[model samples]
Target: MKRRDFFKKGTTAALAAGVVPIIASSCATSKAIIDDRKKDKWYHLGTGKKAIPERKITKDFEVAVIGGGAAGICAAVASARNGSKTVLVQDRPVLGGNASSEMRVHLNGVNSIKGKAERETGIIEELLLHNRFENEQESYPVFDHVMYDFVIREPNLTLMMNTQAVEAIMDGNKIKSAKCWQATTETLFTIRASIFIDCSGDGLLGASAGAEYRTGREGKAEFNETYAPDEPDGWQMGATLLMSSKDMGRPMQYSPPSYAIKYTHEDAHPRRSFKWFQDGIWWIEVGSKGDIIADAEVNRHKLMGYLHGVWDYIKNSGNFPEAENLALDWVGSLPSRRESRRFIGDYIVSEKDMTEHKHFNDAVAYGGWSLDEHNPGGIENISEPPSYFHYHFKKIYEFPFRSLYSKNVSNLMFAGRNVSQTHIALSSSRIMATCALMGQAVGTAATICNKKGVLPRDVAKNYILELQEQLIRDDAFIPNRPANDANDLTKSASLIFCSTTTSGDAKNLLNGISRDIDGNINHWQSDGLNAEVQLEWETAVEISTVELKCDTNVKRNIMMRKDSKNDELYGNHVPIEMLKSLSVHGRVNGKWQDLGTIEANRTRLIKFNFKPSKVTAVKLKLKDTYGAKNIKLFEVRCYA
Candidate 1:
């Protein structure tokens, strides 16, 4: 039987039997054989235990994204949305990488900033808003489902979970195929694609394809980075084991395993806080002076040992009387990694690029997180502080496209911590939201490459402006570059408004500025609640698409969080500035007709696609905002 059919049958059997077959090895097939069931026992009919047969499956796509972390998820979604046939391969059973339930690291983004309009708006914001709407409980496992829904809903994307991409097939300098093993179904996937993105924190796909990369900190002289060591060494950031505990409302005793290590007051530093029993316990880390990728299993075991030791110290140590009723709820088996192999690209971002705010003509993304570098000794270095904050940007800085694609390997790109950067730059750009922006940028560049019949490097050189404009149209904010309105049909039409603006003019809608950049006001704020804006052309024009960019309250936080806090990042509420109900009308024959209507819009970018018609004018009526008192919008666009 074919491997696809075998997976179908296995899924059907799992549904009927109420149990899924556990994958023991990559060589094991999904086929089941039994004998002597009448004796109330089932036994294999084979003479002896044998390896399951290997099933080879070949497929093709325009783009293949490896690793389903925040970067991979955004890359695959953007690629598919941009009309590319895309495939996303993930080694774990669920998506979201460290942010998934298996690891439980909170998704961090521009929220680390104090007061500014630096929020990331594109696909990542869409996913966050969806989680707030669908996942009301704010559960981590449910957040996994939210990510799955986000990818599976895209028609041009194929998602393969529990599949590890092990090998890269090369044709000269370009990657021709990626070979993955799905142990759950005993299938070996040979995926052929035009472009490949390595969002895997380890950069395994790029490394296997002979892509030039760095594994350790570079010397200060290499990139002129002041934060680097005097001499280069193979010491990357350590991996962490996180745990969670809750108040049981009653006293509970804890038991320690035989292998658990012993911890004392002197073992950990006074700055390390274990009193809050939260999920993101980043201190239980181990690995340095060892190959993090090759020695992952060893580091995981060490992290677990240290984690159990810390728990024992909390429950058994006489110093903590407040832990009498607290009980451990969950302890992650997989270690959340901080750093690994970083791919080499045309331009490697350095500490000076962020600190000095270097300008790039090909800038595609922005990041503002502080330089947070953990100690090399991790938990072992108890005498020193856990982390060091080298620097923090006064405002967000631009990330260029040159550092996104590979320098040596053609048709190769990467995102997340594996992107081309000095160790100091990675410290700030490694945040999940920053990685998501890079993913969106690379995914968009891949689509342009597929459509234009060029490589990733060519997209950076020739089609850089097109790529930036497309990203802005999709609601991604570039630090200084405003949205281009040269080809927008609404730019030529005269605006007719039912209600005048109270603060800003209606012409600000087509001014091309979407967000507040460098203290510039770009959006149009109206006085009344049910205001209307219309654009009329001199002659009947054919219109097929209309895009409206609304306000999403980027200054506030809308992420789903487990802890209820007074801060903005932990608030799990929808943005009040978003448009909830609206209607679009078109004048075809001097009479306005209904074009489309949005009932419960939650995203910042609302796009409407309809059959092309000779419409003389298009009108947009705002019925109500999500909860805001008035109507506000950045831009209104029409396309032929």
Candidate 2:
């Protein structure tokens, strides 16, 4: 059954089960009493009913993320990890937006377009790596739980699922609180935060907070974008209803609904590709002529009709005999939207910024997806291609921090597709993985703003270098910017190695680059493992933090999936070269003392912090790797 039909039938049963209070004949209250009671409390009488008991909750956090998609997930995680209390509010029961079980769209990122070298790192990579270790089936629903696990593991993050952020309480130009309503439990949530991130693809939080925004396409002359129309038009990309089919090994009959649209071979002419039918159908789309946000239900209804119509055509049109045993495995109830309101920011990114690779001083994130603009006419345009691809990038282009915060709303910031970018640039930057990078950048910035008692724009203007450095320290990679740890004791202290490999230098550990940078430098290799590296200070130095960046084979794919093709972005297992066992020792009272021991470490970056100790020297002893025969490391740093 469709999700809507199930909800309708379930509501009736829930009412019968006393889930909703009904007026009883024994306690018939007078009209005046009912009106008086209604004045004080919000309730539904004979006119309407509610399922769960109503309640209200008010809480405060450092950051509040108003969506649970890839961008929101990363934003919440990054903020929480950066020493801020964070809350993640998602309307749906699951996370991942279009990549969830409801839609089944693949999670595409920099890897999808730019290749392995530029694959997005940080929270998104950690989640992907976690999914690889925990989920083996590669099922959509399992992926949902994987995302849930990723959020719940963070002690500083609170996950509020099945909660819709319906209203925004504003205090002048800043958002005071986000009013959310939960239909399943009938609970209202008033979340107050110092900073707010609207990763919602629709930019609903920004809209409710009165943030300046733009919708639809821009004129060519406005930004000198060749792909745009000569005159401005209120035509945006349509939302799609994805579907999946599986072979049942037996023929199954399909009956069309009365609302289903009729289709013929001539209707789907040259643009249709229906030969394979196991995954998402990207073309069953609608909603370009109407207000996508206000008329979402209307567009969703049309998309359902188009989806059913296309499925009926595949089954009964006698197009392919192979589809005789094929059955519709699943269909998304909600429309996965593509374009909507894009909040205006300090600087708006244009098509030329992406196409010409324009440089920005505040570039924090990067993307390389080709400019993929779907036709506004959708299924109605039979002769035109489903989407027009204007150009591809030679390398990943940078996205600036200036284009991520509101122009007017002081404490408001956003990521995902709603970030400050023209329609032409958004066409390329709207990919999920690219949005994940932007989310991480903004989330990190939000935490810093909260700690330093400043606004997002102020951080962008004054503390951009600090934000970029923090992101790099947390495993995020920014092109053209090399890592430099000024606090590293190795930069000033003496370095010594017990042994060396044929082509490895112990001094490369202080070079600062973490991962493989264009397959050149910033890494040291020791053959045959069981190597030792030591740093000696002439005078006892106060030290409290130690960081290590190990090699994780960035050139290969580590994403989890059943398909083991080397060419694909996702693979079957973790990288073999990661450090598995290691030990550290520090000189205390003229004797070496064990500081810490790590076994079976999986992440590429690891850090250990302890009470401040005056140590004369520190030593690192490496034992084994997950699979590699040699010990390879990128950089190591000690901060006092």
Candidate 3:
């Protein structure tokens, strides 16, 4: 019988018996099995050939993003949106590093706990929204090709996959160019950019550029992080090759190759293991204490062998007679890495920041995952197995912008799991969702620096606020929203008075139109007036032009003070002369009102007021000229 068919049958039998296979190993194999068909090789899927070598090809870009992971993709999209000619380079054929379809790891984060969509802005969110709309709610194990298509299709983005950055061209403290190798042709290419971002999880660019960095833990007193150990330890979290299993019936004889399993609870310190099920799949996370990159292949083989051995025990051994049908299903292609190199940035996130919930001056992102540290060695001598687990930090913490830039390199920035942070801090912030936000911030900052003809360091010093504003405007959560300062009623009035509500029912409000009684209106309709209500005094106010969003496929009609005897309205209400659709910054002018172009689903509050001396009633009208239903209202407030 085929291995796959055998496993299927085994799974059916196990299920019928109501038994879950418990995998445990007590012996180690001596000889490594070499599988020629399954040998791991880095291939260039784009060009369909091996890497080629050639002379350096130099090209200048506004921003160069290294590493095509989640963070790198977000950064590239941000830079492009900010009008920077951006290039994205990756060592693999796919765009997503760990979360790629090839790798098959789901994007995980705390946002799911809060029932919030991923907190990233710009392209990442765009991709998620697209997937959500297209796939409905069945979009788990995301298609990696969609991610690749999204980045490659961007007009301002240049994507180079299967290209490995080999060296950094530096002049003084700034990186002038990045030297990359084309895997298919084995040719070299030189990419020059005004600003550079390091999204590589291993700090590859930082190391190549001679940037300062640290690996492993510091002494207890070094950063004053309470979790810092008293003695210096070399231990770090290990990597894992996740596998799944199903059940089959009938007894099967299986024997482990020698030296397949090693160590006992006595040999390993802090050895532990556990299991869980999610998304209708059984997951097994093994291997927590070896060098992730160096021992990737070895661990992969060991895991495969161990899984088969566990199946043999379940079928042939009496310990699991009820699990006679259990068998291995699929194993992960890439090792899920937990820790490696951490670059030194302008600011190092210490355990103190996490424990004390320290506020940052240039806060750009947030993280809520616990400080999860895995043991560093295999369970050779231990009586129990080693595992991965989290240590609670009690509160969520903010990550500062300074931690995203290289301390020693002026043009270099970093994001993803490799940002400037201590081992403990990285453990919590390394998740893909937080890294996506970091990528967006870096991309926006790089765009600003390129447009303004400045360095990344200058962005941190001078344009940090601008960068923060851009991120917040795009829906990323910055630590604090700058307070509205001016006291002028007209000038100070904002269409979107308060931030979008994050509570229930309001959760999907981003998907609909909403209005508050105070005249604050957020139009989520496809073909409706995108406007906000601002109150100037209790009743007296001016109706700012109703902004017509450009990207909207349909047209909308706007009428005001329907009951007023002397009411006036402006702009075209007809099909062609109607607002020619609006985008993020597009606006249309009406005789008595001005309409600004707004991105779809953006929060727009229409401002209006009742005259204390005029009448006792006020009315506003919005008619959807095209698509879906009429205007949607979120809240309505009355002022004294």
Q: Which candidate has the top score in lDDT?
A: 1
TM-score list, all predictions: 0.90, 0.87, 0.67
Best by TM-score: 1
Q: Which lDDT values do the candidates have, in the order given?
A: 0.81, 0.78, 0.55
User: In model 1, what are the clashing residue pairs, if there are any?
Assistant: none
True lDDT of residue 139, candidate 1: 86
Candidate 2 yields a Cα-based lDDT of: 0.78
Please write out the lDDT profile of model 3 over residues 1-640, one tens digit for every residue: 2111111101111111101111111111111111122334547889897653333467888899998888999999888878999999988777777667445555554432232222333455455544433443232244456677778888999998877665677899998888776655444678998888988787666677887777666667888766666755555555555544455465444465563342222332343432222111112233322244444445555554444444454445565455555555554555666677778888899877876778887898877666765434432212333433446644457899999998888888999887888877877788786788899999999988877888877888888778876675454655434312122222322233312222223212232222111223333322335432222234343332222121111112111111111212211222222222232211112123322332233222323332322212222233332343333333232322
> What's model 1's overall lDDT?
0.81
Evaluation by lDDT, superior candidate among 2 and 3: 2
Off by over 4 Å in 2: 1-54, 114-116, 250-253, 265-271, 496-505, 528-533, 556-568
**Which whole-number lDDT from 0 to 100 does residue 446 have in model 2?**
94
Name model 3 segments beyond 4 Å from true.
Answer: 1-56, 112-122, 135-142, 246-274, 277-327, 378-390, 482-640
